[model samples]
Target: MEDVGLNQGQVFLSQNVLITPKKGDTYKSSRLSALDLQRGLIMCLMAFSHCRDYVSSVPNKNLSWNSPLIEQNISSLDFLQKSLISLVAAGGFYMMMGIGIFLLWQSRIKDGVNPKTIRNYLVCRGFVLVTVQFTVLALFETIAEGQFYLYVGVLFSLGICMMMAAWVMYGVELLKTKSWFGFSKIEYWLPLSLGLIIILFSHGVIWSNHHYNISPDVLQIALLLGGEYHTPMFFIDINFTPFPWFPSVALGLIIGKIVTTKKEKAWAPLCALAFIFLTIWFVIRTANIQGLFFFGDYKTISPNSAPLTWQSYMSISKFPPSLTYFLWSWSINLLGIVWWFKLEQIQPKLFTSFKALKIFGQNALFFFIGHWFIYYGLSIALPYHLTTLTGIITVWLIGLIILLPLCKRWYQFKSQKNKNSLWRMF
Candidate 1:
């Protein structure tokens, strides 16, 4: 699992010192606890969105971020819930995924593990994720639809990005070994370059899809890249497309590399990045321009339908993730990382309260897949019981109560397994 991205023995900064725990040792660092707290909180809050989708009386399609804010049927509460859920989940998860990759690379490389072996393991783990997406995760959709509904959701896109990250790491290693001039900061430069280029490219593709009459062949390809798709083959939905979302992972890698190496010095620059991203989001939204790395201007919303306010304007496009969405999401995400780190040190008791829920974060992959089943199962068994937003949230709370102990057990089981164990794939 260390080679594939879940590295429990990762390096973290504690009290301005860099600490990499020994193999089979524990992390006493607040930074690690903060990360687990953040992840656990994300996983726990994410279930509310899922419960709303499966059990709420409102039609699921009407609950999407793209739906008109002025729609007569959608309650303001539901709209706010869905929008907030969409805002928080993926940006943090993908950033953590990138961080895991770098930490694994750093740990294994320090132990003198072969780079090729690490790359191969990453590729294998990625394919396993893809397989799980198509099989286990797809089972519910296929059975419900009565056809082969291939849904390319988060795990599928993550697997593709993981494979791509593997190759990128391999190339960095190759350059380090074979190049004439020594390249010291290749890791930082590479992912940063790739992330920016992909962001620009994805924005362009999405723009083109909106304005152009694309052929079916190109449209299918666009589906894999970052554009919305329409096809008659069964029923399909891609929650995340590989290319556009990969930037989050890339950005995480850059941050992880810096924090693990530069230690405390990383804090200033990270805070600055969060500020810059926030500024860009505000400027772009206010400017109301829709070209060259921006899309879905705030003013584009139908003015006659409803009174435009700050809240309405802030609810930007999420699916296929417009540049504004990425900027806004990651700005908050970056701030959270730094905020958590500081909070843990200044207020240990409060941090401990949150860290107690780290069971959900520690076993995030398991919790992610298991939660879908739990909520969906609840929907079937208790059909029509969850008619209100309160009931939906009640179900979400109950699901977390059930998942917490289960996640703890799973974490314990996973802990005993060797690095090569297949259980680590979760």
Candidate 2:
């Protein structure tokens, strides 16, 4: 569950900030109490992780398989605990992207928000997300990948998710309007079917081999529909299309229906589902199957060192969002959602201290893009060896603290500007 692409969800923390309404908005997307709480948790972790990333004194915590080049300085238990926290935050963030989309659809159905309005905003947002990342994130990747290149990540993932969510909502509406489905039926099964279809089609044999590359055109597929994975070296290939990933969006599509049900503590089940999914994925991944996603030299390094496992198998589906990927990512999302609800009663104040984290979650594209320049751009200005544990932690903590106020200011500006704008309708 490296989820490098999930950043597009702006869900690096949950997409709740993106989906939920600002107090200033004329059209409000009712806040998910869970999202706010979860969001706070997600943002805080982002900051903590970043801080841990840069500090000089502490040891690195190696948990999860994403890093083949490094091992954490921390002890095993510390790494495991930190890793689990990151997973909940990361997984919940993506699931929230799906939840946000689902809620938007429901809001349109029940409230005054027009489909055209939502569609237009998404179209515009999609463009922004892409351009921002290409400018910002691509630059960062160049540090490792060399030169500016397209990385179809979370911003890209979300742009694609938004576009797909629009179409899915449109189809849902069309079905309702045409009398092809009844209200009662639509409520229960439309979303359920959508979620199931996406999982089945994506995980099933029909779409299995359809992987693509990360490039400009390939990314466009992520926006318009779902996308398949391709070689990191190439941008497009036939095996790749925005197929299975659409299903993840579709699965998120179901989240809207579930939220709208107004059942007491309805959020609990989503959390439970996430927990169950993560537990299962963790168990299965222990067998080394999940590591299939690491289809590279990294796999040979051994799971103990490289963190490779069969759960890594979903690495392929990340673009189209393979079955294992969906279960793994979505399940974490579910748990985040469920946990937030419980956290809300206590209304933890620690969440706000990390409000700077939400700045990225809010207008993720800007922070994502901006951070790259700061991360790499500044490196050019203040050259240093980042390979050492101290250098990395120093950079991360300095970035988080400095960015806090900057992010807060941006959040205020964006929140105010978007309120009157038609963009708030979503």
* Candidate topping TM-score: 1
lDDT of 2 at 162: 59
Q: Report the number of clashing residue pairs per model.
A: 0, 41
lDDT of 1 by residue, 226-292 (tens): 3334466676666676777788888878877877776655667878999999898888776653223
- How many clashes show up in model 2? 41
TM-score of 2: 0.65
How do the residues 83-188 of candidate 2 rate in per-residue lDDT, one tens digit apiece? 4454344445455666666665555545576776766655665555556545565656656445434555655555655566666666666677664475445644
Instruction: Please list the residue runs of candidate 2 whose C-alpha ends up more than 4 Å from where it truly belongs after superposition.
Output: 1-33, 36-93, 108-111, 135-148, 178-180, 185-188, 191-195, 202-242, 279-320, 347-354, 358-360, 381-383, 387-391, 418-426
Instruction: After the best TM-score superposition of candidate 1, give how far the Cα of residue 277 lies from its true spot, in angstroms.
Output: 0.9
